[model samples]
Every structure is written in structure tokens, then in C-alpha cells.
Target chain A: MAMDEAGGAPGAAKKFLYVNRKAPYGTIYALESLEVVLIGAAFEQDVQLAFLDDGVYQIVKNQSTDAIGAKNFSPTYKALGDYEVTKLYVEAEALEERGLTADDLMEITFEDEDDDWAEKPSINIVSRADMAKIMSEQDVILSF
Target chain B: MATLHTVNKSPFERSSFISALNHTVPGDKVLMIEDGVISARKGNTFADLVSSALSDCSVYVLAPDLAARGIAEGDLVEGVQTIDYGGFVDLVAECDRTQSWL
Candidate 1:
């Protein structure tokens, strides 16, 4: 693996898809997985975050971790844009099955560098089939 | 070009370890971490399953996790190696990709 001057991967960026299929709070997987994403952002890989199955609840708006005595990291999703980790794919079927829609999710966006810092929605509502195709195309898939 | 499969759950508690083992191919590597280190202990009930998989793939257990769980180095399965976090990072970089069986 070649490293650039900043000690980052120098070759072609690998496509990394983080598959989140588990619900948050109930387990540490979701939080720890997010930590990996944050750390991996420095690697300059082509990163895509996918929320499927019960994972859809992770981004639900108005999450109050107060009752659970856990530090709420929901706001971290909003800051992903600063790390250039903006692709957030939500599975359509997952939401429908859980009686949720895109409306229930927290609005996540990134500033478009090419568009004069115009804000663009980060969440891409995709069908399960399309998400599967995306998964197949990824060079690296990190599931949690 | 093989995948580094990470199993973080204990075999006695969950099926993540077995699922990871089942999905691993010949050249793939399995790294047992956290509670997954329990499966790597010598003389365990799952020793046969792990030993069988060792014939096809390499198995590793996180040293710190093993220590935390009071599993001595000598107690690890015959072919299983103990690696530090740096070794874990190297394994991830060496493999084509990684799959966290959480």
C-alpha cells in the first residue's frame, strides 16, 4: 500500500460500504461501527453508509438518549460532511417494514464544494435491490 | 486478496462466530476479538469446529481480549495465533476487505 505525504493511501480510493443492519442503543455495535467510519475517513476511501433492516432506526429524528444514560451521538451524523463521508443510503423496504419513511429520518446534508458550498441532502433513499447492487459493486464491504 | 472476517461475539452466547466460520473461504482469515476470544480457548467445546476450520483458513485471537477474559496464551487452540491491535490493523490492510460479524 502506497502512502502519500500525509501518510494516507495514495493509490485509487477503494469503495467501502458500511452495512448497518442492527438497531442502535440495544448493542454497542452501532456506536463502535460509527467510530470506525470516523477513523476510516482519514484513509480517503470512497465511503458509503447503508442503513437497512432495524438499522433504519439509527437515524430517526428526535432521538433522546437521556433515558438510557448513554452519550447521544446522533449529532455526529450531521458532521460527517466535514470528513467528506456524506453518502448515506437508506433502504426503502426497511423503512416501509418499520412503518417509517424518509420523513422520519433526521435531515443530513453536506456542503457541495463544486457548487459554491451549496448544501445537498446526504440521504439517498434506495430500494433493497438497488442497495444489493451497490453492495456487489463495492471493493470493500464492512458490515456491523 | 482474501477477506479479514472479524467475529466479536462469543460462540456460547451467539452464532456470530459460527456464521463467520461458515462464510470464510480457504484463503480468508478469521480474527476473534472481544468476547469472540472465548471460542479460541483450548479444550473448549467449539474446539473441534475451530480446528476443522483451521485446516482451510488462518485463525487469530486478539491478545488483549484473551487476557481480559482470563484466557492464557497457552490455552489458545493449537493453530490459533494471538495478535495485538497493530497486528489487527495489518491484517485488515493485508486483506482485500473486512467483514465485521457483529
Candidate 2:
């Protein structure tokens, strides 16, 4: 097999990127997945998160859980930046459908440039086509 | 690319999943989770379609999901990899991308 600049296979070092498409709190899966990603960051692995479709609800600004008695967890996503998980992305179109803009989000910061998350990070997001390429390049992938 | 497609609902009840599978290229990995693992139970109709479409792909079920629903690995369609939470992490770590069909 041909080797790449990293001395591994062409795409061996990239960290795991998770695609979360479900509404948060509706099911335990999304929350659990986020927890796992947070743990991955502790190991210094690169982790990127993308919210599309109903998943955009997780990032919606000012979500009130008082009606449902659910302990407001939406704010926790904002704290992901504190974990150094800066590759936060939402589908350009999903945002429109949900009538959300960056203004409507909770300031979950992103890296200055696209791939600036880490020097040897294993996680990040790409466009849909690039997502496919990254998927092909990844050593592992998971969805929850 | 050995993509892992995790479906979380029944195939008939949740068409988004089948549609998601339609986008998958052959040899992709397909794992069932949450309510989606039910589709792989033996004698189920959805199992037939999944078996036909991604014959070359590896099929798997989350052990907790199957057990909670009163289904067993032995009750699943032949060849599905019944895995635990750690295995689930390994599965995510092994695939390049994951499309969750809700």
C-alpha cells in the first residue's frame, strides 16, 4: 500500500467525526453520543460534530425545558468548545429549514479555518462529497 | 469504503432508513440500533429486503437493543454481528462515515 505524508496509509491519522441527525433529548442516543465524543476529546483525538435535519434542534438558541421537566441540556453543547471540539457545523440547508442562523445558535465556537482544529487531529467535517471522501479515509465511523 | 449505516427504526415503519440504505454503495457496514435493530429479527419482512440489498455488507445488532426488545442474537437473521457498547465504539472507530436514519 502507498504511504502518505504521515507515514501511515493515505488517510490513517484523521480522528472520528460524528453525524448527528436526530433531535436532542427526544431520545437518549444523541445525548449519549455527544458524551462519547467528549470523552474522545480527552484522549486528544480530534472530534467534529455536524447537525442536520432535526439534529439542528440541539444547537437552537434559548431552548426552554421547563415545560417538559427535562433538565435543560441544550446549553451543554455550547460547552463543547471548552473541550477543544471546535469543528462544529450544521448543514447549510438544515439551518434554513429550521429558520436558524448562527445568531440563533449558542456560540459553539468553530476553528478559524476549516481544518484548524488540531495539528494531528482525527476528527473534522467536510462538505457532503468531502464527507464521503473523509468517510472513505477514516479508520472508523459511527452514528447514534 | 466500508461505511457503517446505523438504522434506528423498522424498515417499513421508517422509510428514511430504507432510503438511506439505497444511497449506500455495496460492501458498506450496516448496523441496527435503538428501535432499528428490530428489523433484523428472523422471520421479519424487513430482514428480507436488507438481506437482499446489502448481501456483501456486514450486518450487526447492538446486544442491549436486541435483548431489551426480548430478541436474542440467536433469533436474529444469520450473519449479523451482535456487539456490545465497546464494540459499538470500535465499529464507529472503524468506519469512515455514519449516516443515522431516524
Candidate 3:
């Protein structure tokens, strides 16, 4: 669905969008989807992550699951950049509705090897309309 | 004649919250946890619905989830109550049956 406008090149890297909506630790979706992304990173596809609704909590800083007795995998998110999955789209309305700001989230960065190996933030906060447009442009959408 | 219903999804995102509310008998309890706590926040689009549900069943929001979502006690719908995991366990023991609105 993403590369259709690009003449459907058979060997071209397909754009894969991971849509995250549920809150982390509340269900298996968030962690499961993260695992999928890490596993699929081997394919070298163009991957973009979209976090909206309660999914924004997935990246929120200082999450302690000790009381809940669940594994805290939030740290794994920071490692995503190492896999070359650098783009992250977070919905602004979702953060505002939840009384959160980008400052509340963990810092994730990737190095721009092409540009003198400069480190850059990976999270890109977007409006709902912008998020919709980004989703429409993806070749594949994976909902979590 | 009482059942404790647990709703873990946001009412705005999933119909399960409303469906559980609709299926509740009088004297039932509806406890909001995880993303479901968002519906209990004051001035939300579903605030009126939650206020109405309080008349039919006791509505409670999990305290931890509220804190996680940055919802303070003062920000809850007028009639909503907040509870912690211990209270959650108490509700389960007090009720004859437990239903999960997934």
C-alpha cells in the first residue's frame, strides 16, 4: 500500500507502519508489537512507529512495574535506534488528553551516519491530521 | 444480586466499556482500570455517560492507572470513586461473580 505510487518496484524496500494504541503493560499488544518490530528489523524494511491514544504511555519515562510484578521493558524502546528503526510518530492530542507532554517521555536517539554520525532524537510529535496522512502513506500497517 | 465488572479498555476506543455498563444489573459495581480510567476523567465527552452509570452501579477507577494517566482525584467525574489493588481484591471477594469487559 505504501509503494503503489512508486511504480511497485518488486525489490524496493516497503514502508511498514506500526500503529500503537493500547497502553503499555495493560495488555500484550505493546510489547508484542515491539518484539515484532525488532524481529522484522532484519528485513531492512522502511519502518515507522505511530503511537496514539493510551499508547503514548509506552514511551513515558520512569515506569516502574515492580508493584505489578510485570517486567518493565520500556528500556527496550531506546534500543530500537540501534536496529535502524529511527522514525517514531507520536500523536499530540493523545499526550494532551492524557495530561502528558513530550518531556514526560523517555529520550530516544539515533545516529545519522550520513551526516557525520550526529545523534538525533527519534520521536516526532504530530497532530491527528498529520498522523492520518502519515498512516495513509505507509505500504503496510501493523496495528498493536 | 451484585457483580463486580472490570473494564480495562478506554470507553472512547472500545465498546466493551459501554456494553458492560449496559449489561449491568442494579447494585452492580463497575471498576475502571488501565486505559478504562480515562473515561472517568472529568469534562470528558463520556463524562455524562459515566455520571449516568453511577446511578445504576457504583463506578470506581483504579488509583494507579489514574496516577499513571496523570488524572488526579479532583479530576474524576463527580460520583466516581478511586481504589487501589487492595480495594480491587476486596471488590472481588465481596461480589458473588466477577465479569471482565475486555
Candidate 4:
């Protein structure tokens, strides 16, 4: 309901890539970026997310924040598809070195409206080289 | 005395670790503290980067910090020396100056 502000007149849509490089819960960077991504999606922009290094940990399942007394917002990521902000690029190298695997991440998907509403995965595991190329193609890059 | 280069940020979070490594001299020492110790893990993507710096700089990690993060000594990269607070103090005294990377 609050996202209505971003739905003002849609201008020429530009490619916006938000790069998340911080670990979840270490600071406010991870959650802040997600918030911006959700709010930004309302503008009819070509939005995407890139999770690398510690950023990959943001989507890890079974995240518990009770000890830290912080509100667990991990569940909020599942709502991104409702905002039409899919395309989450996860660096394969980041997971390998962190002793994590694709199986460890939360399942996030979106429905393809054009293809008779087929469900498609938003989490795309990509190589570092491919990540580099994708980043270069973005019209604007937002770092968090 | 050689310089003591300290990195307090996680390598994965920023370029601080790599920047510190790039600025080191052949005999300089690099110490990881706080979240910077994350890069010292043997299996992480940055392990090779740390290993490459070993030929030119002596790499160290704070044992307490690593323990706090639940990273075992055995899981660290080869040649990465683990030290206590006293060792950290000694490094500061042994070096000409201490430089920190945010």
C-alpha cells in the first residue's frame, strides 16, 4: 500500500542493478538494500539484484536472530516477486568459498505473466566472470 | 621496522582487505581483526588472494576474533598465523607504524 508513491508516472525505464556485498545482520546494509529494491520496483524500472561474497548469506535459510534481538526479516525476501522485482543473481564463487550451496538458500520465485503465468526461479547462480559482465551492462549501479 | 597493516573490515564486504594487501611492501605485515578475519578461512573465495600476499607479506589473524566468529584454526588458510592480544601488541611495537583499512 505504501509503495503507491513510486507508481507515479512511469518514465523511460532504465536498468538498475543493486549490488549487495555485506553479510546479513552484521550491519543495516543488507536489509536497507532490500528495502530500496522493493521500493524501487514500483517505478517500472528494469531492476535486478546481485548477491556476492557475504551478501550471499543474506538469503540463507534457517537464519535466527533471537540471540541478537533483531527482528528476523529473512522472510520478507519472498515478497519480492509480488513487487515484480525478480532476477536475483547469486555468485557461485561466493557460496563455494563460504562452505554453502544452492540447497542452503531460500526458494524465491516469480510468475511469468506472459507465459500463461508459469512459475520461474528468481535466484540465478552465476560465475564471477558472468557477474562482471552483467554488472557492466547496468545503466546504474547502487552499492550496499 | 616493517609496517603493520591492519584490516578491520571483511574482505567480502569491501575492498579494504585487498587494498591493504596491494599496499604492502615485501617485508610488511598484514593483520586481520574484527570481521576482516573472514577472508582467512581456507575455503573462501578470498583465500587465494591471501595466499598470494604471503610471498610478500606475513599474514596474521586475531585468534579471539576468529573464535568469536566460530571459525576454527584448522579451517584457516595455510601459513596464516593465529595470534593472541599479546601478539597483536607485539606486532604494533615491532612495526615502524600501524596502518588500518576501514
Q: What are the models' TM-scores? A: 0.59, 0.57, 0.60, 0.58
Better of 2 and 3 by lDDT: 3
Q: Stretches of candidate 1 above 4 Å error?
A: A1-10, B1-102
Model 3 CA deviation exceeding 4 Å by range: A5-7, B1-102
**Models ranked on DockQ:** 2, 1, 4, 3
Query: What are the per-residue Cα lDDT tens digits for candidate 1 across A76-112?
Result: 9999999998899998988998999899999999999
Model 1's TM-score against the true structure: 0.59
| Top candidate, metric lDDT | 1
Which of the two candidates, 2 or 4, achieves a greater lDDT against the reference? 4
Looking at model 4, the pairs that clash are: none
Give the interface RMSD values of the models in order.
5.3, 3.9, 16.2, 13.4
Tell how far residue B85 is off in model 4, in angstroms: 39
- For model 1, how does the per-residue alpha-carbon lDDT over B18-86 read when each residue is reduced to its tens digit? 756655667789999999999999899999898998997999999999999999999988999999999
On DockQ, the stronger of 1 and 4 is 1
Share of true Cα-Cα contacts across chains kept by each model: 0.50, 0.37, 0.00, 0.00
Q: Sort every candidate by lDDT, greatest first.
A: 1, 3, 4, 2
Residue-by-residue lDDT tens digits, candidate 4, A78-118: 99989998899999988998999999999999998988989
TM-score of chain A of each: 0.92, 0.71, 0.95, 0.91
**Candidate 3: Cα lDDT at B102:** 57
For model 4, state the Cα shift of residue A128 in Å. 0.4
